[model samples]
Target: MASDTDFYSILGVSRDAGKDEIQRAYRKLAREYHPDVNKDPAAEERFKQISEAYDVLRDPKQRERYDAFGPDFRRVPPDMDPADYARARAGAERRTSSRGDPWGGGTGTWEEWPEGVRFSSGSAEGIDLDDLLGGIFGGRGRRGGPIPGSDQEVEIELSVEDAYHGGSRSLTVEGAGGTRTLNVKIPPGVVNGQRIRLGGQGAQGLGGGAAGDLYLIVRIADHPRYRLDGRDIHVDLPLAAWEGALGASVEITTPGGPATVKVPKGTSTGRQLRLRGRGLPNPKGRPGDLYADVKLMVPHRLTREEERLFEELAGTSKFDPRRRR
Candidate 1:
C-alpha cells in the first residue's frame, strides 16, 4: 500500500478491468518477464510484480479489498467495516515506519510487502496470500479461533489395466507436519481427472480445529495397446492383408484378457468391431463397451512363391483403391 508503484499499472491493465482481462494481462506479462524465458535481470523483478498483481486480482474477495484500498487493503480484515478499516489504517500507520507496510510479511509491517520475494508457493499462481494472512492473523481476527485445515490434493496414476479392473492402492500424502500414508480403493471405472475424496486426511488444524479432507485426482497412465475414452475402450487389432480382404477369426488382446474377434470379409483399416460389455465395468451403472480397430499388416519380405501368387492375383483381380466406388 505504501509503494508508489501501482499494481494495475504494473500489470498494464485498467482499474476497472474484468477478472478475465486481468488474468490475460498477468499471463502475457508473466510469460514475457519470467526469468527462465527472459534473460534480462530486471525481468525477474517484473515477473514478481505481475505474479503478485495476478494473485490479488484473481481472487474475488481479495480483488474487492485491493480495489477499495490499494495494497493496504490487506491491513484491514475483510469483515471489518469501512470505519474500522480507517481506524486500523491510522493505527497501523502510527505503528509502522514510512518503509514498513501493514499488509506485508517478512521484515515489514502488516500494510506492506517485502521486496523481490512476493510468493514462493508452487501452486497455480504460487502461494495463496490470503490463506497465508489468515493463518497468520487467525487468532486475532477469527471468531472460531482456527478454521479446519486446508484440503490437500494429490494425483494418483493408474495403469489402463488397473483402471479397467479397479483395485486397492497405497499412497503418501504430504501434510503440514510431514507425510502420511493412506489406503485408497480405486473405484471400478473411475475416469481420468476424476477426484476421490478421503475424509479427515488433510493437514492438522490449529487450536483443536477439525482436520481437512484429502482429494485424490485420478490420472490414467498411457498404455501401449489401449486407448480409453470415458466408458469406451479401443484396441488395435492386427490382421494380415488376406484376413482383412477375405475375412478370418483373429485373436486380439483386451485390457481384461485376450479374446477373438471375427474380421468380416472386405474389412478395411480403421474398421471398428464393437464387443459389448467387454470394457471397464461401472459399479454404479452400465458397463462399458470395447471396440477393436482393425490394422492390416502386409508382409515386408515375401518369398518367391508368395510374390508369384501376389503377381497372379494382381493380374486377375480388378481392385482399385484410388478410384471412387
Candidate 2:
C-alpha cells in the first residue's frame, strides 16, 4: 500500500510508528544525509527529501491528512471523503495513461511523478507534477534542520563549610520530566552567583542536534559565625576585658578549622585582625583572607577581689575616662 516516496517510507518509519520512534528514525537518517554534514552533491537533494517527509509526518494534523490523501493530500479538499479522493485520483491516472503525457506516461503512482515534487497546498483540478512541486517548495520554506538544544540553569545551595572545602555532592532535581539525581562537584572558593557548567546535560536537541549545557548557579548558605563577602570571611571574635587590655593569643573558629590569632595590647572593640589565606580555599587562584572583628565583653557580676583590683586601677591610672584624643 506504500511507495518509495511515501512520507513514512522516506523517513524509514512504519505506518504505525509512534512519535518517539519516528523522531528517532528521522534523527538517525538526518545525521547521515544532512547537507551540512554530508559533502556529497546528491546528499543535499536527498536531505531535502527526507526533511520534507519529516516536516509533514512530525505534525499530527499534517500526518493525518497525508495518511488519508497520500502525496496529493494538500490539493484535496478538507471536506472531501478519502474514498472519493481515491476514486477521483484513479480516474485521473487512467486518463493520463491514455493521453501519454510527459509525466512518465503511466499509472499516477508517487514514483511516476517528477524526480522532486515538493508537496505544498493549493487549488488544482488534478495532479500537476510541476504545479505541485513549485507550489510546495515555494510556499513555506520550512525544513528539518538540526536545532541546538537549550541550556538549562539550576540553583544549588551550599553551606559555608562545604564551599570552603571542595567535594562531591549529590543533587536531586525535580522537573516536568520527573526527578533525577546528579553527582555535582563543588569547587572551593566558589562565590555566590557563580555558575558551574556541565556540558551536554541540558535539553535534548531536535534533528540530531547537539545537546545544550547545564549551568548550576551556586548559592551559599548563611552561617551563624562566619559572614561571607566574596572570598573573604568575617567573624566576630569575642574577648574578655582583660584580654583586650593585654595582648594574648586567642583561638578562633574558621571555616577551614580552628586558628589562633594574637590580639594587640591596646586592642579595642570593632578592631579587625587580618589572617591571610585562612578563609575559603581557591581552586583556581589566590585564596581568600579572614577578618576577626574584636568584641570586648565585661562580666555582669564580678567577685570582690576582681572589683577591688579594678577600683585600684581606676584610682591609680592617669588615663581619664571618656577623654578626647
Candidate 3:
C-alpha cells in the first residue's frame, strides 16, 4: 500500500536495504541532526522523525506490518484488505464532512460511537472496537509509559599533538539542566568526526528508564606548523640556498619528537622528502608517513665580502641560471 510517512524514505534507504545499511544511515543522520549537536529549531523535529523511522524499521515484525498497513499499522488487523479499508475510511471522512463536523465529532455515526460498543459485524470478544477504531482515526490520547532519555552529541576539539598521543582531559558541558564537569579520555590517533561514546552520561531518563549515551565528536584543531591528511603529516622544510645546492642533514620537529631529514644534493623548491612511519601513530592499523616540502631561502642582507664574491663569480663564471636548458 502507498504510504505518506515512508520509513525507508525518512532514513534515505531503499525498501530492499539490509539491516546494516539501515543502521549506518541512521547513525550518520543521528550524528548530524541530534538536538544537542544541531541548534536549528527544525532539527529536533527531524531527529524525532528519524528516530521513529529507525525504531519501526529496525524490528522485523513492525516493519512487516508497516509495509502492509502504512502509519496506522498498529490499529489495523493483519488480514484486513488495505485498499478496501482506505475506501471505507475515505467514505467515512466524506460523510463526516457532510454532517458539518469535519473532525469526526458528529453524533449518531460509528465514528462517534458510545463506549464499549461493538461497531464491527463479527464478534471481537473482550476487545473495545470503539477505542480501537477511534485510535485508528487519530483519536488516541497521550501515553503514560516510561520514556528513555535522549541521546546527546557534543564536540571535543584537540590539537594535532594531543591527537597523536592519547590522554585524559576535563570537559565542562552546559545544557538545560545546568553545567556539568566530566573527565574524558581521548584515544590516540582519533581522526575528525570520530565519535567516542560514554554510556549513561546524557540526560536522565523519565519513569525509571535507562539514561542515554553521550557521544563526543572529535574535531582536530588547525596547527601553525603541521597539516594533517588522514594519518599523514605535512610540514614546511625551510633550507638555505647552499643547503639545497649541497646535501645537508637538518633537524625537524614532529608530533612524536625531533627527527632529522637528509636534504639531497641538487634539490629544488617544492621537492617533497618523505619520512616513513613518522606521522600519527595508529594503535590498530598501519601508521602514516610524513612529507616535508622543500623551500629555498636567501639572506635578507648580503655582507660586503659576500657582494664582492658574487661580483667576481658573475664576472668570470660561465654558469647562467636564467639560460634556457
Candidate 4:
C-alpha cells in the first residue's frame, strides 16, 4: 500500500536503506531534535516524527506490517484479507432490520424478535460489532498506552582553549517545564562534534512514562592565534627576513604559557618548530605536539636608513634568489 507518512524520509534514510543506516540516521537526528537539546518551537514536532518512525522501523514485524499497510498498520490486522472485510460488512448489513432503531429503543426490530435482541445498520456505513469492540478494547487502536518523554539535543559553544583545558559552565533552556538553568562541568580534552549527555533533562513524560535525556553538542569557536588538528596545535611564528638568514631565539605563547624557541638559521616560511607534548591532552593517548610555523614578514614602509641599507645590500650581496645555482 502507498503511504503518505514515509518513515525513510522522517529519519533521513533511503527507501532501500539497511538497518544500520536507519539506526545511524535516527541517532544523528535524535541528537539534533531532542526536545531538551533543541529549544526551537518546531523541534518537538520533528523529534516526534523521527521517534515514531524509528519505533516502527526498528521492529522487524512492525516494519513489515508498516511497509504493507502504511501508517494504518497499527489499526488493522496484519493477516486480515479484503474478502474477509467484505463478508463481515455483508453480515452486519444482513443483521439490520427494516426499522431504523439500533438497539430497539423504539417498538422496532428487537421487540418483534423478543428479549435480548440487538440490531445493526443496513448499509456500508453500518457498524460491525467486532470492529467496535476491538476499537474500544484497544485491540488495534492508534493510541493505546503510555508514551515516553522525548529526548533533546542542543549546541554548546566553547573556546578552543576551553575545550583543551575544560571547565565549568552554565546553560539555560526553555524546557517543557519552562525556562531552567543548568550548571555543566565540561570534561577535559573535549573536541568538536563530541556530545555530553544529561539524563532526565528532556521533555515531560505521559502516563507515568520515564523522562528522556538531553545532549550538549560541542562547537569550538575559532581562535586568532591557534589552529587545532586532532590533538595537534599550530601557531604562526612571525620573523624578519634577516632572522630567517641568521637564526635567532624568540618567545611565543602556548596554551600552557609563554616559552622561548630557537629559530634555526636559514629557516623559511612554513617551517615548523615542534614542541612535544604541548598540545591538547587525551585520556587514551599521549598529549599532542605543538607546531610553530614560520611566517616571514617585512616592514610595511621602509625608513630612509633602512632603504639605504637595503640599496647597499642589493649592490653588494652575492645571493641571487630567483636564479638557478
Candidate 5:
C-alpha cells in the first residue's frame, strides 16, 4: 500500500498543476530538504521521496494515469504468485541497497564475511572499519576515479533584430584542451535568458556513461532606439518639424525589410504608429506588431535666409506650442 503522505500535499501544490508549476514546487522543496544543504539525517530520504514524486508527476501521461487511478492503482495484488513477489522484492532491494554492480554481470569483487554468513556484496563484511563506515553513511565504494573531463558553459548576446530573424552564427569557445568554433543556430524570437540544449557537447561521461548536454543561454543586447515587450517591438522615430505638421510618407527599417509608413497630418510627438504583423514571432508561429513613437526634431542652426522666412511665418501663424497643456 502507498504511504499516507500525499504527493501533492508534500509538494504543497494541487494535483492538477502543470509541469512547470510542479517543477517549480519540486525545486523549492528540494532546495529546502537537500542532504548537502540541510545536513540532517532525514534530509536524504525526504529528497529521494520528492524526486520519486517529481519523476511521476513531471510526465504528462503518467500524471494523468496517476490522477485518474490514485496512488495504489499500480500496486501488485496480494494474491500474486510467489515467484512474482520474489522478483518484485528483489528489484526493490536492488534499488534500495545499491550493493551489487549496476550492470547484470557480477564480475566485481565482493567483501568477504565470516565463513558461515554473507551479507550483500557491498555490505559490511565480518568486522572491518571501512565496511562499518560505508553502512553508517551511504554505501559508497572507493571505486576508480572519475573519467578526466571538464564541463563548460557559454553565453551569447544577440540583438533584437537577430532575435526576430533566425540566423546562423559561428562562435569561438576556449576550453582546457583548445579553442573550437561552434556553429549555432539562433531561433527566431528567442527571449533573453532562454536556453538551447546541445546533446553530447558537454563533458564526456565517466565509465562509458552518456555525455552531458551543453546549454547555450541567450542574452538580448540593449538597443538605443528600440524596446521589446513580449512579441511587440517599439522604436522611437525622430521626425523633422515639417514632417509632423505636413504629414508625409517616411521609410523605416523593419526586421523584414525597409517599409514606408504614412504619417497622419497634425501628428503629435507622442503619437504611436503601429505596423501590424511586423514584430517578433510567437511560440504558436504567429508574428506580432511593431510600434513607432514619433518625436519631432527642430533645427538648432538655421541659415540667415531660413531664419527670416521662419520669422515671417511665425508672425502670420497663430501657433501656441503649450496650448493643450
Candidate 6:
C-alpha cells in the first residue's frame, strides 16, 4: 500500500527530476523522517512510504514499468493458472535441488520424476501422475518477463541566445553498446535543469512491454553580455559622456531583437532603463522585463581644438563628478 504513493510527489520531486536529483531528495527526506530517529506515531508509515517510493524509482527497470503503467501495474493479472503456477514454481525448486535445469529445459525434454509416485486428481480413477507432473513441471516460464527498456538520461548545454529563441539541435548519446543521434527541440525560455522526455526511445521492452523514455536535461551557458534572474534579463549598457549628460534615445540588443530605448536626459552612470515584455516568457504567457544599467564612458586624448572647447565649457559650467560623494 505504501508503494501506492505517487512516486514523484512522495519524493518531493518533479516528474522530470533527474536520477541524481531524485536520489538526493530521497536521501535528505529519508534521513529526516527515518522511523528509527523519529518515534512519532506516524513516523513508521511516512518512512515506509518514502522507502517504497525510492525502491521503485531507484531501479531503472521497475521505474520504467511503473512510469509506463502507473501505480496500478502490480495488480495486473498474471499469465499462469493457480494450480499450474504452484506446481511449476515447486518444480523449479526441485530442479534446482537436483542440479537439473531450473527454468523448464528447452522445448522437448522429459522431466525425470521418482517411480510409482502418483498425484491423483480427486474425480475417481487416478490420473496419470506422470501427465500431471509433466504439465506442472513444464519448463520454468519467464519470470517477470521482459519489461520495457529503462529510461535514458542525457545532458544538453544551450547558449543564452538559443534559450531565448526556441530552436532545434542535433545530439549524440554514447552508451555501453553504441551511439545514437537524436534531434531535440529546445523550447524558448527553457531554464537550467529542465528536462524534456522522449517517449518510447529507451531500452527495448521484454515480451510485449513498451519502450521507456529518454530524458534530456537542459544546461544554460553563461553569457558575458547579460545576466538572468528568473525571467528578467539584466545588462549594463555603455553610454557616451554626452549621452549621459543629455537625455537620448539609444539602440540596445535584446534576446527578441534590437530595440531603441529612451535614456532620460541627465541620467547617471547607475541609472536604470526598463523595457517591458522583453524578458523570458512565463507559464501564463506573460513575458518578463529587461533592465539596462546605463554606464557613462569618457573619451581619452582630446585634440587641441577639443581642449579649448572644454576649457571654455568648464569656465561656463559647474559640473563635478565628486560633488555627490
For all candidates, the clash counts are 9, 1, 0, 6, 0, 4
lDDT of 5 at 138: 25
The list of candidate 3 runs beyond 4 A from truth reads 1-145, 312-325
Tens digit per residue, CA lDDT, model 3, 1-325: 1234788998999998889999999989877876656879988667767866886788898798887667766445444566655654665565445444433333433443322222332223423433444433333212323334666668898999999997998998766678899999998887655567788888765445456667787778889999887688999999998899888999999999999999999888999999999988888788889999999997899999988977897899797778998
Q: What's the lDDT for all of these models?
A: 0.69, 0.71, 0.73, 0.70, 0.64, 0.67
Candidate 2, pairs of clashing residues: 120-136
Better candidate by lDDT, 3 or 6: 3
Give the candidate order by descending lDDT: 3, 2, 4, 1, 6, 5
168-216: candidate 2 lDDT, tens digit per residue: 9998765544677999888777866555778777766544556666778
lDDT of 1 by residue, 1-325 (tens): 2134677898888988998898889768766875545779887566655665776677888778877766556443345465544544454445346424434544422332221113342223434444434433322223335545655668899988888888899998776698888888888887654557787787766555567667786778878988876667889888899999999987778877888898899998999999998888888778889999998999999999999999999999999989997
Better of 1 and 5 by TM-score: 1
Clashing pairs in 3: none
Give the residue spans of candidate 4 off by over 4 A: 1-147, 303-305
TM-score of each: 0.58, 0.56, 0.58, 0.55, 0.55, 0.56
Which residue pairs clash within candidate 6?
104-139, 104-140, 146-206, 247-265
| Residue 60 lDDT (model 6) | 82
Model 4: per-residue lDDT, tens digit, 135-204?
3223222233333466676779988789888999999877778887889889888765565778778776
Off by over 4 Å in 2: 1-145
Winner by lDDT: 3
Better of 3 and 4 by lDDT: 3
**What value of lDDT does candidate 6 attain over all alpha carbons?**
0.67
